[model samples]
Target chain A: MTTLSAGKRLKSAVCSTEIMVIAAPDGDVEITCGGSPMGDGATNGGAVDPGHAEGTAIGKRYVNADGSLEVLCVKAGEGSLAADGDALAVKDAKKLPKTD
Target chain B: MLLEMAADAFGDRVAFVDPVADSSITYAELLAAARTAAQAVHDSGAERLAMLDVSNLAIPVGLFAAGWADVPYVPLNYRLTEAEIDALLERITPAYLVTDLTHMTAFGDRQGVALTSRGDFLGMARGGGGDEDYRSMDPEAVGVLLFTSGTTGAPKAAVLRHKHLVSYIFNSVEFGAADEHDAALVCVPPYHVAGIGAVLSSVYSGRRVVQLANFSPEAWIEIARTEKITTAFVVPTMLARIVHALEGQESAHMPHLQSLSYGGGKMPLAVIERAMQLFSDTDFTNAYGLTETSSTITVLGPDEHRAAAGSEDEAVRRRLQSAGVPLPGIEIEVRNDEGKALPTGERGEIYVRGDQVSGEYEGRGSTVGADGWFPTRDAGYLDEEGYLFLEGRADDVIVRGGENMSPGEIEDVLLEHGAVEDAAVVGVPSVEWGEAVVSAVVLKATATQTELQDWVKQHLRSSRVPERIEFWQELPYNETGKLLRRVVKERLDSA
Candidate 1:
């Protein structure tokens, strides 16, 4: 229910998950964690749903099916991420070599 | 946040080492120190945190402390003249200044400044007064401000936000990629972009950092052997010196060294080829980036380097000279002067778009266009396969003897001379230094080259003085009256 621009950090109202937007299409996009809408600086609310008990992994990126939405988990949470009612898939492991 | 992650993952692991001082800090100790030190920085009420010293424990502590304090961390060049450093310090007032013991007495005290020796600062960091809950999570907050000597005017602070640096780390580097035995030798000064990148990247990757405050070929090689170093990043000049130092040694192989990356200036093909032959098993990469991009945006990985070295095709062989493809989440394009994207293999200005790209300065808002692309101003062409070849660092920067100097900085000093009416400084290829500063001037009164050189030496660092100053009747300019520095450089190259 909020504008999701790139670089925006959002928190799940129902979980400890903190995600940073990697890419987003123009306008507002519905993003949820454990069936509850994620928000910027969202406070902890209802319990994590048993149906969404799948935990989010730290340092992994999640993307929507259409590829228009992407978010990276900076911190892990008990609830998994979803975009527009579709569960986001973990992007493939990065192939870029270590250049630092 | 980055440090917190590292501390959580492996608090017992060694995080940093100072070979010169024979000191080291573990991840847990570093986190504790940073948190405590951040309190002092916050209590000082400084708007920014500044460090004017070589790489040491203070470096990581100061950076993390600044992050915790929610202020921009500024690392200044120690090589600049006292007056030059003062000029820069004046710009960032109400600042917390950290310096090594050698510079303890250099500055007495300023009205809006808090100065502390590096040793004392570390004490403060480890003394146990910290805020356990302090954290700056706003991604848009400025993280680091590196002073870049511009092609015109005084050096301006290039801004890097928390997100820019974090994006680079998250995309290019996997968390906890380094094993406990992994160590990286860092020789570049703290002021360079590569140095900052080395610290942040190595820390995030869980590699122990072995820092050498002063770089000597013998010291660098000996430390690598002693520290059991596995990975490292060096600039072109440092690699060249090491290559020369290893000459004629039959048992010169560093088998433990896994990866060796070089950038910050053009790598002489001959130097790289010789090093490759010497260390046949080592992984060599070329990283191309600007301070504004928050470190590496493109990488010429080891595979590409080896492939180019062994390839017989002229184009494939030239890939060694090309900067490899853009990193994931980064996009690059070559465009004509009018900003139209050019086809592959056509020369044009380079522009990049990415979450990591922070094309901003302190006072200036941002150089990025409305479309999110930031013009690099570096002339280059993208090959058919998307390799980027840089014509030079920028059209104007003179990277000489491993130091980057602005032509305008030298030209300004030359113009201060009473005898000079107009001056144009350019870098021309040289045998020893990759590029040597040479200037052409139209004099209003009589002046000798030696006299002008001495004048520059008196005003600025000796390295900035042009090696050669030629008397010219007039300097070339385009129809729009922009000075054609490339023409001057071409004339000097021919001469």
Candidate 2:
């Protein structure tokens, strides 16, 4: 688990000896947990700017085929489970069926 | 001159190390290779040559060869389309094109061959007449023809001379404090003046340069760590990549990293602060200049950063936001519409005159006035202390009821908001206000245009607030990642 924070914390991740998260895009999508809204180079755009949070499992939902939204995040141990907009939150992600 | 100097002093010392393949060329070997290449090209009956490759060992070799052969070298932008290349070829009408024969199909019978195809480059030089001895001649003799980024309109070639290149290297050391031991990692495209400047500075100083054929986040970290890179000349976009790459790591691998130089666009204060935090020991030098000027004319050193943070004086704080003080040989003056120099602390066009500045573009009317000062088209002011602060481009300034409003100031304020990801402000024609302030922003949170407008109104004056606000997924920017104000305005006009 990486400890990520915003602004100064974001910079601290860059130069300091502190462990920081290096997020790579899985295409035009991203997944995050225990990461600050000040996530380095994360795209958060829409009417409501969903602020990122630490320990709050969050993942991006890209517009998909059949005009549906597919969220790319792990639920329980299911590894990269997909859900609609309603199941996008961390709590919903946890409540979904576990694979193991 | 620098190559000759290096050959004389360093001799067998490693002059260039190709980071891509881990190959190197010693100074003595490089001199021989360049001589051989020059002979081969001269033997081929070509009077001039165009190099189409990216940054690598061959660039310097080709440059020296061209110089020794007394032929002009034209560098083609890799980003430009085939049509653009064809157009450039038509304009310059070169006698030969020298690039790696590996990519022979890319040129398609235009010109050139491998340096080894004839014979071992250095060994082949034995019997041929020695390279034509050439002294640096008139400053107007074209050394390179660089094309401007066509963000506003069609691209035009800016004729660069040997004197212009010499001026850049001398002033860069004066401003950037570069040295022979300094290792600079260049991430910008080699086609651009900044990229070329990085290569030239390294060669001129005889320093080790780690050339990135292409920029990758992982590669940047690895290079900085393994090479003990002391300097990184980057665009803001590249810096963003570095920041992103360091996200989950305990610490950046660039412990030996000293300076991160930025230009090509206005860096948001948030970005600067974050970069400073990431590399606590590393200095951030905010540089501002244009390709026409070679590279940098002003640099805001790291020391001023702490001063700006400590002082409450608006002037001191504002210095942090300005373009920065003029480099040693360059003099900048703020002039009014009439071209009369403005008093200190007044806003006007930024005019620069110096030995480092370039002459007028070839076959083009003088951009520099009769007085030898180039009207930079950048709207800025000279503070009482002689620090130069840039507002925006003169064309970007929105004149409403005679008040000069800088969109950059508004954009900076918007970026300060936590919800804002990227912001751009441009002027749109208005029926009532003569010109309306329109803002296009990419937000991190869900917010209405009203919310963003209200946010701006709360922080800025009523007149400065945008008349209309629009949200975009991303802002339109040039290849250098500079926000395109003209495009934004055009989008608004079409909308």
Candidate 3:
């Protein structure tokens, strides 16, 4: 478990997955990959579990329900991601009308 | 760091396309090229990396490389005269200048400067000859040095730091928000603030960018259609020309164009209304900011455009003329000459405060106040609902016999006339009234000066009418679409 902040990058302890925080709520939140807590730096050394092997996709944002916390997948990995035991879903692409 | 984020997020996605070269690069390839370019900059012993070429793949490479190497990226105006270019080059000595073959020959032998052709720079970027790793740069370090378009006076280099740009992107754009098929058309020159902002924001949002070096109404429409460009930004003058180009057509004929944003000058109400009708499927945004404000501080968003265009309420419809409210994390206040915040609906100088508002010049440190507010030097007022209506630059305001008047106000009324194609209002010297409001007009159809004068008198007070009106073939405008009011004032004053 670590304190969450915007722009902080977290890497999977046992996979090639890396995620950067886009938005975060106050308080410590446990962010995990392959059922293991994510670390502060990139280190691709971990076993992938068959049950959690859906993997993260590059260029997609993963967010929790209620849309308070969001992380952008920086690298693809063979491990699914979760936050606080809840599986994060890929965020829906926003319509381009909001583009500046 | 912005490019790094994009590379990591969508390395396999195409980041940019160079149609003229018949080439494109994925985000990963662009990242690698930037790293290599950074190494070359380091090896060249240049304190700053300057690009004087037209828009191309190498511009982004040079921009990101400068950031990676912790040097200020300076993009010079390629349209300037040789003497003007040489004068600017002398200011940023010990610089690595990237240009085309023609300009390289013209400037390659200048002392204290290392010249690299655009082709050579692109080649070096793709060659990946350097082994040095990309270094993280400080957020406070100057990231870009943009020489302001000197509409009023000699150009000054407005400095933008990494923090300001990063904050702007973070606050405004969601990460990885764009669809894979989305591409943005960027036609503005690299030296313009919107050009830099567009490159950074589009890359960070994981969208492909299609750049047009030279702009023409026909070419822009053709390219936008062929490329299936989903989003685009244009200056007001560009939009006006485009509207004129599409005259008599049922629609813009661009089904894929989702959003169109215009800024960098006052957008005429007639032009925007016609644009909204023509590009019926497209969303329109009026983004207002300056070179010192890191692109957009206030945006009349798509929703507001739609609301104003479709509304029956007069107040709501008038928002189409306003610059809209401040963006997230940005605070705006209209202040009087004594620096006191003005009441709602009272016109005064617009002041802004935000993480993205740098307001710093190269030699003149920061102009931001201790309270963090930076007077924008623009005269405007906020509605009761906080929509900002810009009234031209404060210096451009006409003081006629102790009464203050905004040129934008007179110009807007002139533009509302059906016969007027374009109009510029400037303060000309007057022996009796201290200063007089003089107007230069470009008419679409024949209208007598008396008729146009009566049109303004009916819309506004008699004092707001121009003391003298001059008919012109066309009003003067800078390449980026800023009305050359100084030129107009000089001409009218001399006459």
Best by DockQ: 1
TM-score of each: 0.81, 0.75, 0.89
Ranking by lDDT: 3, 1, 2
Q: In model 3, which runs have C-alpha deviations exceeding 4 angstroms?
A: A1-100, B101-104, B129-134
Q: Per-residue lDDT of B73-152 in model 3, one digit per residue for the tens?
A: 99999888888888889989899999994844678789879999888999989998444563545667999999987766
The true-versus-predicted C-alpha distance at residue B238 of model 1, in Å, is 0.3
Model 2, stretches more than 4 Å misplaced? A1-100, B43-47, B100-106, B110-140, B174-181, B248-250, B309-314, B401-403
Q: Which lDDT tens digits does candidate 2 get at residues B1-495? A: 546546655556666677876777766677777776777777777656566666777777767777666667667776677777766666655455644435434554544322232123334543344454534333445566677776667677776666677666654542112355667777777667787677666665566777877788788888888888888877777777788778765556577787777887877666666677788788777788887787788878778765775578977876667667777678899999899999997888899987657746657855877788999888888777788777788878887766778887788788878889888888887887788888888888887887778888899888888878888888887667687888888897788
Residue-wise C-alpha lDDT for candidate 1, range B435-478, written one tens digit per residue: 99898988989999999999999999988888899999987753
Candidate 3 to truth, TM: 0.89
* Fnat of all models, as shown: 0.48, 0.00, 0.19
Q: Candidates 1 and 3: which is better by TM-score? A: 3
The order by descending DockQ is 1, 3, 2
Error of 1 at B364 (Å): 3.5
Off by over 4 Å in 1: A11-16, A25-47, B134-136, B150-153, B393-495
Query: RMSD in Å for candidate 3, one decimal?
Result: 3.6
Q: CA lDDT of B279 in candidate 1? A: 78
Listed in order, the DockQ scores are 0.47, 0.01, 0.24
lDDT, residue A62, model 2: 23
Q: lDDT, candidate 3, residue B338?
A: 94
